[model samples]
Target chain A: MASKVVGVREFDSLIPLLRDRGYDVIGPTVDEGTIVLDHVATSADLPIGWTDHHDKGTYSLDKRADEAYFGYAVGPRTFKRWLYPPRQTILTIEHAETGLVFKPEPTADERYAFVGVRACEIAAMEIQDRVFAHDAFADPHYVERRARSLIVGVNCAVAGETCFCDSMGTGPECTAGYDLVITEVVSGERHEFIVESGTDEGETILTELDGRPTTPADRKEVRTIIEDTAASMTRTMPKDETYSLLTENLEHPIWDSIAERCLNCTNCTLVCPTCFCSTMEDMTDLDGRAVRKRRWDSCFNREFTFLHGHAVRFTTKSRYRQWMTHKLAYWYDQFGTSGCVGCGRCITWCPAKIDITEEIAHLAEQTREEVAT
Target chain B: MTTTVTRRPTVAVWKFASCDGCQLTILDCEDEFLSIVGAIDIAYFPEATRAERGGPYDLSIVEGSITTVHDAERIHDIRAKSKALITIGACATAGGIQALKNWADVDEFAKIVYAHPEYIRSLSTSTPISDHVTVDFELRGCPISKHQLIDVIDAFVHGRKPNTPTHTVCVECKLRGTTCVMVAHDTPCMGPITQAGCGALCPAFNRGCYGCFGPSESPNIEALREAWHEIGVDDPHLVQALRTFNAYAPEFKEASETYA
Candidate 1:
């Protein structure tokens, strides 16, 4: 696919084009103090020239010195909330003369064009795709939603303090899994975007837009910006021995130390873009009509691992260990990839400010000490 | 030809020594309350209806804490007559804000609050219902969310375990996609140690979670205190955080005492 350069002023044209192609364009918009994903009608809705300062258990939005769209990192919310909603009704039942009549709720196949998606988020979506659509039994609702959705990826110009995507090898640049990829360029007095088509749909959308062919200099500038982002990231994960490091140290003392600070709040899993655990609920009306719904569940919850009459992971230590290990180690065996995308929503949102990268690094240090001894 | 008659399960709502916030939550379920009433017999709900029915009740939903000697005895009788006794709100489950008295002298509290200390009657400590009698289940919250309350009623009525979550407020915040106040703003939120029920209300509004739902299952309070300390949260503030609504809960009580 060929790349094209579009002026920042002309970027608004893509909204109407996406809407014309029967897509409800959803993009990042500032809600309250943070940027949240919502329906975008114009280019003005995007958080232009705005950046956010984020740390472990901290985030603050600020105005940028230059005008650049998609300036911030990922927020507390993820694209999964759109594809697989927090609460969804699966089956409805009614009392009949014989017994009960069951009716499966029809899936709403709304075509969504997700704008301003980050590289780490794209990786997170792929992880979820494997979990829901490519699993042993595919979830029909998730499959329908995934099939109808169109991803418009945005390369990160500035990484948050908590971001470790470079080490995770998942981000700072949107490489694949997107229909269209965008990289914003902010030179003195001029702001533009270097856009690339990753799919036929993206190519068709590009043809509708008023954009010029990109020069070699323009492509080189985009490359430089992505390289700078990757270089600026301070956080990193122990990629090589992460699986064995975690699995082997199931009974490590570090687990106990981290467990003490872990509220077993399940905040990490909840904010995690790739965490896909869910639980079923049966609700009945006064008229004896019942609906079976599914809501997002977390492993940190004792009820999540309930078997027979007792909880399996009864302690906070066990639950925290389970979540971390599942994300960094066990996930490789299950999905052939690590669960974490290094977006760091968990670190930012955790009340205790527990950093996963720090935990992984600590474990790696322990491994080094053991090897040295 | 055969004729069949089915009787609705009898439910009784009881209160102890705390605010009627939990009972108000039941009334707040306006649309669903009608449906719930249609399915169950409201045998005794002093807050809603005056028509009282005697038990052996099929289900008893108890609110508030056992602060008075009389309340302490009354819960045992209620437990004996009810098939299933479910404690709702932090009061009935952990002891509520009044449990702050657990750290101080109850006699001194009576002297300060009451004009005539002789007229006042209260136990040394406000205790959860389970401390006195067996609780079939417990729904933790400052004032329990109505949706969860409905789940408990529906589940008990259907002879099944209620699907109320035993997770922390973090899970709810994640589900709602609310920004983390603690992480983003350096605000100390109790979402991690707190139980899930209030839908992560405080955090959603850019405030820290006060742990209104009490401690989650196996909460590591010592570690949380240490973490908070590292974040510059002083010992007094940490103690005050744990000594809030669910102060008498074993986990919070022990954690608070460490700081005290």
Candidate 2:
């Protein structure tokens, strides 16, 4: 069935209704240096017309087009924070003269309605589901939290310089993962969001809100607008070729050239929504009684690979190789999926300003010609 | 004293030749601290509390690299005693970042991350637990994922193999709807060659990967090296990347050498 549209005036009333439905209403609210996703009681808290520009360790509030809610591509944080979480209390430990005790981290929490979710973010959530929900040992915590989420996807009109969603075949337009998809249309009277019910939860919420049945003409217009947005992508990705080329050029001179410029800060991993590697810590109290905690870890840290007082990837060159190979080549064998989302967060956040797409594109053209010759 | 509920599982977090990060991860379960203590026996973890309780443990999480004549022997003792032995982190599973030292001058690496290279007792290469012992299960990652840790524990408690994927990071990138960093930014990324245990953190963080988790079930390092260079990553950089956490991993070691 075709999706309908909700007028701008009526969308405001739906917030309280969502709350009444027992959902912890989460929306974009500008905080600290970035417009982070948090709870919003009213629509007034939305960053209307305010956009964001982010670089490595740098974020700024930028001007936007006429009070838009989903103006930015993405920020430092991802949905993984709530669903997968950085550090979880998997089990508790206490030491007694007899032995040790274990307590599982609880699974119950309030249902969350994540509003203004980017298409890329929703895709990230789905990937995590496969990791946490599949097979013999599922992470109960992630499963439960994910079960309680209501996704609201926002289509992007402005592709950030770092973004390359078009290449990954994921975004510019949110295809799935959202219960509801919203596209802000340029209307004379009001800046309207063309809403479509992607799931039952979205239907229930849409039913509560005042929405006019979308006309075939209106839907067609929406398509054109969205397609135009997709075509306007500032970044591009060269696919299929990356796999073949990267796998063949072990002796290429490019790796060393880039390594000299890499600081090995690990900013790229930190900003990536899919990068889930973390370090664990076991801290015991002074009494040697109650031992507590685990935290986020990065491979960039030299200690990450220490074995018997020796470190691997000791050279900046080695560290760079491990990272790039894993992303483009090894990950293919592990997950049956490419690790690069083309989100471009790494490009924007990289202290070195290294562009993965540019490099891959160059390889795509060069290697194809070389192979052909 | 409160009545003890359920049979306390003997939890032993082990280390091979690693920076102790993986074991530290067990200790770092800050949120699950008291609860973890309540759950397992924690027979031995030198990094956590210097406790040396000998055990026929229910579950043994082995970390670090398998280096040295002594460590190579100690792991045998550990595997023999433990009921269920689970190797955690890259060091335990794939020899770790220190394994990079496998190819290079071990003497030089000892001087790099440590103050006393002279006192360092070590081998040239760092190797994974699977290399030396029969690991019932292996958790991939340079430092392992906190969420995956919980999954592994729960699986062990329930008597099941943990569900770690042996796919490429590309699957994750697609699932996340993230544009390929390599495609979009023309940046060189390693999502293709690495494993999925890391949740594709490098892409999320706006950088390329460093293969902290080690290689997937079967990776084509040679192919990836070529791809990297084609993507503008030079030979020297490719060699360095392969020499990271899982450097001594046979596939990665050989690939890196090809470049060198």
Candidate 3:
């Protein structure tokens, strides 16, 4: 995997090249006063010279000092929006002359090339791949879309205030689960990308670009930028201790305090890249036509744990505990890896400003107290 | 087609103390109105037609709240007559905006608003239909979504439960990929505690949701209040916000009382 140096101007051709290669390229673009993952026809559609500031319950877009294409932290949207849509029609039923007919809904089958994908997001995708793709009863929709899609990983150059990827060992560096990985380097009066191919397809696309052999200076700049992003992260979760600390303290008093501020809004779960839960709904029209749709569900929802004509997790404390435990503890038992990639979308997007890293720290502190006693 | 004498399920629309917005939602179902009419017999819909038929109704779609003693008595009678009574909109489900009068002295407000307060013959409180009689189902919203209204009727006619979700507006916002106004713009939004029937309307336009669809199932109003407080919305403002459309809804009512 030899890395190549692509000049800022040459990088402009990347999106067009992906489009020409028959991909519906989705990249970051400014929308609704924030960077959003949307259709990218050319490199111009990228959130160039723009970055986002992320903190608990806050995200604001700001102008960057340099014209760096991949300068921003992860936005509200992730690649999950495409691979695992919030709502999807799984089956459609219509009345036929002979009898009622049930048919599987047709999927779009578009080849997707997602650009500007962060390293933590790549980790989330791998976690989802285990859930939706590797399982015995694999979801055809997710499997098909995932197989057809290509990921272009972007190593973080700037860490958000809520980010704790370095602590989680997910990354500020693009390590794996990518077809092509890139690191945008911006020096005074110069902007370029050091790119490497993780797959043959990525190499083919890289060959099409006007790139030169990477120099030592380019590699050194990429390393420095990644290291800086890792260093800048102010938030940290005791990642290894989260599982035991959360699972053991099932009835922690801290949960009640957290619940006091937890809105049960489902924003955290909805914005999370790895949180995957869905519920099916059958919609019927007057005309004998019924469609069953699978929409995203969250543990924070009261009805999410409904059983025997009543919700099991009736309190905010229970719901919040369920979500946090499942994300940090139960997820390890189920998927062999932590559900949280530490991308921090959950913290940033939470309307109540509930921080996962902070909660985990509280749990660790409480556990330490119990052990001392 | 052979003419069959099979009687359709008799449908009736009843009103109490609302703005007729929920009933108007029925007429707003322009494309489906005729089909709905064809499926069920509109025995008593004074808003749409002059024809008035007494129930023994198969389905009674009730709108508004029991604002007066007469309306309160009338709801019990309507409930007894109808096989299934479906309460529609905020007025029928959670007492609507007029329920703000529940907290204040109605007579005092009437004296200020009316020339002769003595002329007004109303109850002290505006209460939802459920407060008086057993309501089979309730479709909550200031003005109920037309699509959901149709679903209620369709489900009633077909003998099934309606598909209206009782989740928070945040679920709908996420489903539609609308950015959180409170999180992204520092706007005070009630979407976290508000129900999803309006399809997350306000937040889509970059405006905070005003809880027009009423408090969601098991809504955490206290949590929302604390969140809003952090964003500069004080207790008074939070109380005022909760006292909107679904003022008398137990969750909002209790939360507002705490703040008040």
The B-chain TM-score of model 1 reads 0.94
Please report the candidate that would top DockQ against the real structure.
3
Tell me the spans in candidate 1 whose CA falls farther than 4 Å from its real position: B1-5, B112-115
Regarding DockQ, does 1 or 2 come out ahead?
1
Considering chain A alone, what is the TM-score of candidate 2? 0.90
Per-residue lDDT tens digits of candidate 3, residues B1-260? 11122567998999999999999999999899787877789999999999799879999999999889889788888899999999999999999899988888988888999998898999999889998898899998988999899988878766766888888999998888888999889899999999899999999999999998888887878778778888888999998888999999998889889889
Task: Find the 10 residues in a row with the least total lDDT in model 1 chain B.
Answer: B1-10
lDDT of 3: 0.88
Candidate order (lDDT): 3, 1, 2
Worst lDDT window (10 residues) for model 1 chain A?
A281-290
For residue A105, what is the lDDT in candidate 2? 61
Give me the iRMSD of candidate 1, please: 3.7
User: DockQ, per-model, please?
Assistant: 0.51, 0.03, 0.56
Off by over 4 Å in 2: A53-60, A96-98, A287-294, A307-309, A365-373, B1-260
* TM-score preference between candidates 1 and 2, better one: 1
Per-residue CA lDDT of model 2 for A1-373, tens digit only, reads 2366776678777678878889888888765445666678878878777886644323456877577666676765566766766566666666566777666667869688888887777766766666678767788887888888888788886666677777787777788888888887755556777788888888878777777788887778767866876776667766565666777875566677766665454557766777776655443332223333334445554556667768765655566666766676766776666667777777875535577777776666767788799
